[model samples]
Target: MVEAATIGYTSFPGYPEPPYALVYARPDRADTAIGNFLHGLDLADYHVALERMHIGARVSAVFAAERSALVTDFHWVLDD
Candidate 1:
């Protein structure tokens, strides 16, 4: 499975001028999987995308990928 998200800013304390971010999550990062899918993307691309959205990156975006967790804190919600 895959999940992608992008978020914009708010005026809460400690938040930056325009807090923005983009993230991609997948169950696999193999060479022929999500890793290849995300290949060639870089920091500049992130900055450019944010700029196009007028998000103004006073706070930085986090671009990363890792294996999915075996357990989640919200498991209880699914138990019913």
Candidate 2:
């Protein structure tokens, strides 16, 4: 499982800017393994929600089907 942390906005240039959350392989790890791109109708509210998320929260990543293997989805790990 990956530990999630809200890392703020991405550097990619765009109009409706996208925010990001960093995912760590472990809670004690300092380096980020990957960044999850967040999208919403209102970026401001989305960012606020992201900031409120507790650090080290459990999150899951979904990858695209294409060869690029880019992350296409992200969400909190849910119990069955």
Tens-place lDDT digits, model 1, residues 1-80: 22443444556564334443433333333332121122212224656653433322122222345435432211110000
Q: Point to the candidate with the largest TM-score.
A: 2
**Residue-by-residue lDDT tens digits, candidate 2, 10-67:** 5765322445544443323445555544333233575566554445444444444454
Work out the TM-score per prediction: 0.25, 0.40
Off by over 4 Å in 1: 27-80
Clashing pairs in 2: none
> Least accurate stretch of 10 residues (summed lDDT) in model 1?
71-80
CA error at residue 50 for candidate 2, angstroms: 3.7
RMSD of each: 13.5, 5.8
- Number of the top-ranking candidate, with lDDT as the measure: 2
Task: Give the distance in Å from residue 33's predicted Cα in candidate 2 to where it truly belongs.
Answer: 4.2
